[model samples]
Target: MDSRLDDARGAGRRRIPVALDGLEQWLRIPSISGDPAHRGDVARAAEWIAARLAKTTGAVRIVRSAHNPVVLARVSATRPAVARLLVYGHLDVKPPGPGWTSKPFEPVRRGGLLIARGASDDKGQFMAHVAAVEAWASIGGPPLDVSFVVDGAEEIGSPGLKAVLDRHRGLLGADAATVLISDTKMAGPGRPTLTVSQRGMLGVKVVVSTGREGVHAGRYGGAVIDPTQVLAAAILRAARVVRRLTGAGRPPGPTDADVRNGAAGRAVHRDRLAERSTTCGALTVTSFESGSTAGAIPTTAKATLDVRIPPQLNVADAYRAIAAALRGNDHPRVDLQLNCMASASGVLLRQPPTVRQNVDRACRLAFGRPAASISSGGSIPAVDLLFRIFGRPPILLGFGPPDDGAHGPDERIHLGDWANCVETSICLMGFLSGSVTAASTQHPDSSFSDTLFPHGSRGTAALL
Candidate 1:
């Protein structure tokens, strides 16, 4: 077994070029899940993954969803009693916006980086795991029992993934899971960070109507109530509630020991990320439409409010607070229409000692450094559902850096980091095979055993 592990490591190093070439081929397809016009391309990306895994995998199946399809594949380890790991990644890429040295879909190697729409966000990062699994299969098989879920819709809020996870919860179960996500920025190359928590989101559109129609400013402006004025006042009142819900100022997050002892110690400092830990929820007016002409007082006004809530806050309570705030002081003067567009709960992960030890060891083997723990201000909605299902913290390993530019123009990934990501995944699989123990052995404080709420409150469940 030791000899086979050694061979797998060597084989993985040898297949770098081939693996990169395959990634380029996949990148050539514009699988933009957000754009309905590119739905066919999304399916093509799923088919590509299925075809790639058909030969070495135990089974490859495409789970059909109302939206884009999800690819599921399994690979059995050579030996039994090894831990089963569910690996998660997305197959869809964000729509490329304006600005580029070349076309977004055209994969190009630019000196030291790969520039493409999905290169840094996911395709490049997740492919590293695939390459590692293939290398393992080349020598013997994966060191651990592996299951892969490469979903198709991530950019457009992942309704398809939500539906699939809801229906097939049993099939997705495993001893542990690692989500190979590059959506967050890490320290840099060779320094990997594991994100432990993320902020949740709640968005609502507020519409206000006063008089029947617009009043001419010169004649009737003073006599009629302006809906725009009402909206401005409501927003100011709601600001207090938003503050109460989010914690007014930055809420405390990672400690000095958590960051300095982890992978991000050298790259990130507490002061650098202090603003992201704000306890106060945000209230942004994304869109405002009211008056068409300056000479008239508009009767109707509309605004889109976007809020980012901390992981510790309750989504339902936040929603209620915002609604009450909107109805404050001027409850009868203006007609209010509050529409909730979307809401998802946040995550606060607790890692067991064994998982943390193995992750650090594996990272050192792959990149000559230990992994870091981080708290993300942004949220991954799917994570809430995943946590509810697994009841364990997902191993969040990221390869993308701050400059990766995911979902923005000129997306890219460092070639060196990409290689290290693949190697890290390989080491992770090998380490977990023999080291993983039953969850019962974990220290109560280290594991995710403590409930987030006292009663039957849908803390994480609200995410689904």
Candidate 2:
């Protein structure tokens, strides 16, 4: 093994303490972007990122948005950048709802796992990239022009991302450059996985009104239409509409490869993939309210519907179909209203050959094996928006394992897995250094085949 490779591995291992400490500090901030009470914490988290990136980046600034701030950093190479790579991730996290072995904000390491609110959801995963860059600096500087776009409002649907992305599109990448993201989950512990697709989401509420006030059931039992019954009818109609629009066939069954490569592949047999894929469009009535008593004909009733649209269907079209369905049976007896709360489109990533080859190499160095391609049932609104603006597909590489309990209590990521993530990121820098043209004039779809194996094209290990 090359001495520098040994040095790099040693350098990476030495930074583990710092990575853990950094993640703990970040988790302590309680930067819950969804809660107004934690607004300041969110801002503080952005400042923390700026402060860390300031050491290596020439320009580090927090871009203000309507909701939360965005941290943007730029690192210029000694020689003109052969290519630019945008590292995308979020610092914000979901609120610690309930259930915990310890305080969600207090980071803890049990066995080989680091536990906390944002431990695995994103903070730990994204910071792995930050630490990777730090490790590179310890051994030597990076080989490409790299920029970081760590935002603060990912948990709340990234409502402010579209404007931020559009405003800074040029700064992000003028033509098109590869974007790296680490907010998804790996197949399983010690196994690196790349997510290639995410499902879209649409939330709606159905309100039915029959009269100004509830009527006595005995006096108007058959005289008046029950609002609860009307709401039920509306929900039934919505289901029919979805069926018509999305069709009766099960979502294209997950390919045999999908089942084999998934993180739970060992536990999830091929026959189970279809059952799992059915969850892609699972629709649920999250909430329903009508009358206080069974003896009264309710005056009004409301139902909130949660809909998950598969990648094959258009999110907007599905939402429209839902609206049309609600309006289909407008009658004089009852008034119905369909309120669309939110909708985010799904994404399908196309891994260019250059990215796939280097990422495979990086996985081998990071996990002692090649990576498995997987798909996510969740949605990240910013990803689809970023693709629309940059025209380059973002590489979705994450360190969180399937059992990390993201968005739930005792959220955690394996310390060993995180270490692998750090090593993988470091290897990617070398692999992608000469992979892109230094000049930005190259065509958006173009990628050079030359790989800059700084030390050599070999994977090395110092310590796990």
lDDT of 1 by residue, 1-464 (tens): 43455566667777888889999998988998878899899999999988998878748788987788888887888777347777778889877878666788998766566788898778888898899899989987886778787878766556667677666645554545544444565654446788777777877899998867677888976678878888989888887777655433333345444344433225654453444343446677878999887798898999988788877788888888888888775447678989987777877766788878888876766666788776766666667777777777777777875456677766777676677677677777877777422222222231110121112211112212
**Model 2 ranges with Cα > 4 A deviation:** 1-7, 170-174, 243-280, 292-296, 435-464
lDDT, each prediction:
0.72, 0.73
Residue range with the least summed lDDT across 10 consecutive positions in model 2: 445-454
Q: Which candidate should be chosen as best, given lDDT against the real structure?
A: 2
lDDT of 2 by residue, 81-198 (tens): 6667788899999989877778999887665567889988888999988887787677565666778888898876777777776677656553456788888877655677888777
TM-score of each: 0.81, 0.83
